[model samples]
Each structure stands twice: as structure tokens, then as C-alpha cells.
Target: MGLRNYLSDVASGVKSLLTGMKVTGRLFLRHHKEKITQQYPDNKDTMVYPERFRGEVVMPHDDNNEHACTGCTACELACPNGTIKIITKFDVTPEGKRKKAIDTFIYHLQLCTMCNLCIEACPTDAIKMAQTFEHSVFDRSQLIKKLNQEGSKIREGVE
Candidate 1:
């Protein structure tokens, strides 16, 4: 019975080795027929990223400079690395009621892990991951960006 078990183990091991070798041989033959590799810089114009690629975070505003951010701090609180900073201000409405508004939405690209947690945590759908991968910069200060545009305000009827 011991000898039989040993032979079975050796047979299974040989079967796994053959399966691995077959896959390797298939890939080795495919390498000569297919040109899957792409050259950078030269092919930058035609380069395409995958669907789920995560890049820098950006806040999009409409033509009227209105955004959806309500200054709720949900995105700021959800960020694991503290990449998002929300500076809120109290704006007095025409009805004499003070409302919370976003003053400045600062994003530190250097500290960001691109985990998409902040985007997912936003209740108002305020922020999204922009499909921009070019982040090379000579100065470190350039990496820190303000997500909100100047003179931008929250859209009307948004909670």
C-alpha cells in the first residue's frame, strides 16, 4: 500500500510538470507569432489603458461652474492616507439659513494610494478618478493639486 501511494504521488507530480511544460511551450510559440508588447513614447498616441485603471482624483464641474460636492467630509474621512482635504465654509442663504459649502478641495497626489476609497465613499458623487496617467514633474509641489475650480459652487437642489 505504501509503494502504491508513492507511485500515485509521483504520477500526479509528473502530470503537473507536463501540464506546466505544455503551457510554457504554447506561450513560447505564441511569442514568435504575436506582437503584444508596445513601445512607449512612440506609441503614446495609440496607447490604451484598461477599463478599471485608477488615476488621479478630480472634481468635475459643469459649464456653469457648478459641482455636486456638499462639503460633507465623507470622502475626506474615507481616505486611508489623508490624501483629500475638504475646507468647508458656511454660506448664509437668502432665507437666513447657514449652509455648508466647499471652500477648497485639496488633493495630494504624492500621498495618494489610488485606492478609489474616496471616490466610492462620496455620498454626493462629488469626485471621480480621472484617466490621466502622466504625472512626471520636476517639482514636488506640483503634485499637490486643488480639485475644485475657482468660483465653483455646488449645484442647486443638491443635498
Candidate 2:
């Protein structure tokens, strides 16, 4: 309103600008001294992901290409969004026992939120989050990966 008041407001504005500038100046001066961001893809060799980083669900296979899934349906039941589907069948053993085995383990990545609830629900640790992040596909159907291969047997000693 008055000349003095206007001059005081101008001084306050200048003081705030200087305070902000000081912080930026400090950051700019230290920018070259320390690493702020990683040049991804270029620095893939040096990139370190966290141990618990949930990337994608993968059924681990042993050296014999056998998985640990026992068709328990715990993971399917635990999934809130119905991302995982376990199609099981009764296998007649040599002793004529009706053993349950998974025919197909369909994982719908589009519906999965990566909450790790399925992993937690698994009693045998059959399914887990793999460290692979390169899951981009051209077709939406490609995201629905079958965990178990046809005629694949469950791994021995996997309980």
C-alpha cells in the first residue's frame, strides 16, 4: 500500500529467491561430484536390484526340467484377482492311486498386481517371483504364460 511496505515486500521476495537459489546452487555444484541417476540399459552391468524385488512369477525348474508344483490349488485359491489358474487332473499311478497333478498352470500377467500373495499362500514354495523384468510382449495373450510344460513331471524330493 505504502512505499516502505512495497520496499519491504520486495526485500522479502528477494530473500526467498536467494534462499531457493542457494539450495539449487549447492545441488548443481555437487551434481558432478556424486551420481544422481543411472543411465539404464547402458549401465545394466552395474545396476543392482533389491533382493525382494518382485518382477514376475516363475515356476522354477530343476536340472531335469521338473517343477515343484503339486497341484494343491492353494495359490489359485489365495489369489484375490484370479490371476493364477491351476488346471489339475487325477493321475493313475502304478498302484492305482488317484494322485493329483497339475495339467496346466496358467498365469494371467494382465490381472496380476504383483502383491506376492500367491507366493505366500504356497505351502511348498512351488511358485516364486523371478528376477526377470523383460516380460513385454506384442500380443496380450503372450502375457498368459503356462508355468508347467506338457508331460513335464514334478521334481523328485520336492515336497
Candidate 3:
């Protein structure tokens, strides 16, 4: 009885495999006019990605090199892995009070899962997902990016 049951299971598995292959063969033989495949390299210049595509996280700096990130570490805490590192420094205000500021915003793209959790946790809308998807690089170090621009300061009115 055990041998018979094993044979029956193997037959059912083969049947399922054949059914999946049938569908794939039918699609493979479909007319060329169908939009089943995308010519990626050919249409590289004209490719249009959807607006909701979460490619990478980025901090948009304004014309005056000001960002909205307050070194709150909200994004770093929200990441499932240690993909984001926010190095902070204390800046003395005019009144001699210390305020937290971001010295560097390190983003490890190789470790990122593109979960969008960090973007959602940002209270000041300091970071958001960018649309640039081509992230291939020769060296692994190239995947590590510093989000904040040089000499960038916190934007006025954004804490």
C-alpha cells in the first residue's frame, strides 16, 4: 500500500508539471504582437517605469543644499536590517543650545530589501524612494551611497 501511494504521488506531480509546461508552451507560441516580452536594451532610452516603482531611497536637497532630515534616526530604526546609518553631530544654536544634526547618511543598497519601511517612517518627508533602477556596479563599494549632499543643512521650517 505504501508503494502504491508513492507511485500515485509521483504521477500527480508529473501531471502538475505537464500542466505548467502546457501553459508555458502556449505562451511561447503566441503571436509576436502580444506584449509578453519587453525589449529592455532596445527601449532603454524610452522605457517608462510606473510612478509607484520603489527603486531606491533618496533625500532630495533643495536649491540651497538644504534637506529635511533632522538626524532623528527614525529611518534607521525602521529598516528591517542595518541598511541605513545616520551619523549625527551636535550643532550649537545661536543661543548656545545643542541641536542634533546629521553628519552623514549612509545607505547600503546591497543590504537593502527595498521594503519602503524607512521611507514611511520618516516624519518630515526627508527621504523617499527614487525612480532610478539601474544599480549595477563593478565594485561592491559603489552600492554604498551617502544620501545627503556636501554642505547640506536642515531645511528651514522642517524639524
Backbone clashes for every candidate come to 0, 0, 0
Put down candidate 3 lDDT per residue, 102-127, tens digits, no spaces. 99999999999999999999999999
Worst 10 residues of 3 by lDDT: 28-37
Itemize residue pairs with steric clashes in candidate 1: none
The lowest-lDDT stretch of 10 consecutive residues in candidate 2 is 150-159
lDDT of 2: 0.88
Q: Which candidate do you rate higher for TM-score, 1 or 2?
A: 2
Shift in Å, residue 67, candidate 2: 1.7
Output the number of the TM-score-best candidate.
2
In TM-score terms, candidate 3 sits at: 0.78
TM-score-wise, the better of 2 and 3 is 2
Instruction: Put the candidates in lDDT order, highest first.
Output: 3, 1, 2
- Once fitted onto the true fold, the runs of candidate 2 whose alpha carbons sit more than 4 angstroms away are 1-6, 157-159
What's the ranking of the predictions by TM-score, best on top? 2, 3, 1
Per-residue C-alpha lDDT of model 2 across residues 11-121, encoded as one tens digit per residue = 999999999999999998999888867898898888888878898888987778788999999999999999999998987877999888899999999888899999999
